[model samples]
Target: MQTQRSFAKQTTGTLYLVPTPIGNLDDMTFRSIKVLQQVDLIAAEDTRNTQRLLKHFQITTRQISFHEHNTQARLPQLIATLNAGQSLAQVSDAGMPSISDPGKELVIAAIKHGIPVVPLPGANAGLTALIASGLAPQPFYFYGFLPRKTQQQVAALAPLKNRTETLIFYEAPHRLLKTLASLSLAFGEDRQIVLARELTKKYESFLRGTLAEAKAWFDQHQPRGEFVLLIAGNPYPQTRADAYQHLNLHDYVAQLVTEGHPAKTAIKMVAKQRQVAKQEVYRAYHQF
Candidate 1:
């Protein structure tokens, strides 16, 4: 495990994870602004968008474009700058640097190279929406931006259907209605949900109700602005109704084989149901 002493003096320059405002410009923190001005270079997800933020705050520090498309090519250069004792601040269009943002890979590389990473607390849409969401706050699972396709999104939400902790998700305005409908189908119609939109901005609003109500509301109104979807966790006790629930790993595969499934197919199914690595299941099934 890698440990980071954020404030400790380091031989190489520190990588500051600065959080910009999610909506309101006044939400920018003093420390975040200070770091932005002091850093040698700022790596931003969108240069044009970040430029507007920089202009508003009068921060003239040079910015390099470091987004999903260009991360691979830009990573080495950023690392080299850090090694040269030139501090860098990484920022997304809004919120924290790496929460569904474009700084995780770079952060990993920095840590692997023994560079210190310092994160500053600021505006986060997920947490901001959660506190006011009237849902359980602790033990929340931040699942930012689910897959866009309907089938993929449903498959993704299937596993999370049983989680007890509050769930947070981010989605664009265009997909809000479709996502709410999908959430309704996955978690059922009665599940409680809170939709926080345009957070910290003048038009900030929250729509709190059941999943069914949310779907119906968006069906009537055209969704505008970004959304923070806070879903109440599963309230019912988890059921143990699987057909293979009582079977041992080996026996489970054996039973599937007995039922006319190919050995390889049975092994794969067992691995999926048990949530173990396929290789582990394959080894046990073949050897025993």
Candidate 2:
């Protein structure tokens, strides 16, 4: 004989994925605050930052610090609470948890233990920029943030240059200009780029144009606050008569392969940076 679980009677605990305001408290949803209040525990990436947000809504829910550094050690403890039949919610300092922050590992653990995971939707800067960037919305890649070093950052963006879908990158104000310079090197001077700075804040600004034009724009304006960089999708394949002059694919792939990407991956990467087909790169690799 077995008993089936019902919506109300089951002791099976639930995990709520709540989204917090990225920069503005007004963006916090009523549903988010309600869930925060009712949950047995709140797992936060930054307990200090969460404290500020919680205080604003008068939420007194107990919070446990759960961020990248402590997530591995903290998962088992958090899961034990869930297994004990206590519902919990996880949040980041801002935006949805695990988008580019903590929450992925914790959510996976809860699922393995048969705990239900629910999403309490709210604001997200990534989607905010994508929607307002006025670029192709259906297909896009969100590159949360780049490596701090200029060389490493450029190598990271190198692989995304050829993706036919819109690309997004999160950058701190201090690194915005250097990041843009790296983008121009990988994507080309004429590539279209959109910069959304201090979004949802008092000094929100959008600067858009070719990479060269954008570099000039930023040179004059001092940047301050969070930024979302949206680079337009790659251009359509070129016709023979209209083919534009560009760097040779083989030489480019050889260079990147030397920089540590495997030969196959390098071919694909260079194709992206050159905005051409993988076959274009493959042929060049085999030629030399």
Candidate 3:
């Protein structure tokens, strides 16, 4: 393990991770502006988008495109630049670089090569949303984005259902409904969630309610802008109920049904509480 003293004198140039404003231009820190002007080169996720920001800040630093598709081709060039004692700054389209952004690989490369990596604290969508979400703030888990594929997404979310910490997620407008449905299926309809839309912008809004309520709202109102979803953690005890411990899947669902739920609703509830797919619970309840 290598320890880094960010401000210590070093032979090589430093790699500065700069954070841009997520939506509001006023959120851009003075130090970030100074870093952009001072760095020898700016490695941006999208040069065109960075140009617009640079223009706003009157920062004329030259930028090279470094996004997901070109990470490999640009890695060597960037490392060489740092090795040659030319300071570089990396920035994403918005918010902090490397947090659901494109600067992680570069940061890793910089560290591996003994280059100093300095991060300038600035705006972040996740924490910004979390503070006002009315959910448990500390001991939170930031799961940026789930897999796009249905099965993969389900698999990814299943284990998170039992986590007691608040869950944070980033989602696009188009996929918001699908993700809400998946969250409801995995975490149950009663789970509390907050949807922070267009954070820091003029149109910014937050919708706080249960998973079922969020789904119903989006069904009528079109989802607009990017979203930061915060889900309340499992309020129930982590340990399984003693009654459920001795029951099989079919019997478990049947018992819930006998208590007061419809057959389908019981199956869904069992699937969520057990962290299994609804289909598995349905088949077990039907002996199919």
lDDT of each: 0.91, 0.84, 0.92
Q: Once superposed on the true structure, which residue ranges of model 1 sit more than 4 Å away at CA?
A: 1-3, 240-288
RMSD of 2: 5.8
List TM-scores for all candidates, in order.
0.85, 0.81, 0.83
Q: Candidate 1 on 210-240: residue-level lDDT in tens?
A: 9999888988899999999999988884642
Best by TM-score: 1
lDDT of 3 by residue, 69-174 (tens): 9999999999999999999999999999989989999998999999999999999999999999999998899999988887777777876878899999999999
lDDT comparing candidate 2 with the true structure: 0.84
lDDT of 2 by residue, 1-288 (tens): 323232455466788999999888899999999999999999998899999999989999999999999988999999999888898999998898889889999888877777778888788998998888878886998889989998898778765766788999898888888988999998889988888887888888788888899889889988888999998977763432133235467766676666677999887766776778888789988894
- The better candidate by lDDT, 1 or 3, is 3
- Error at 25, model 2, angstroms: 1.3
Task: Say which prediction, candidate 1 or candidate 2, comes out ahead on TM-score.
Answer: 1
Q: How far off is residue 271 in model 2, in Å?
A: 17
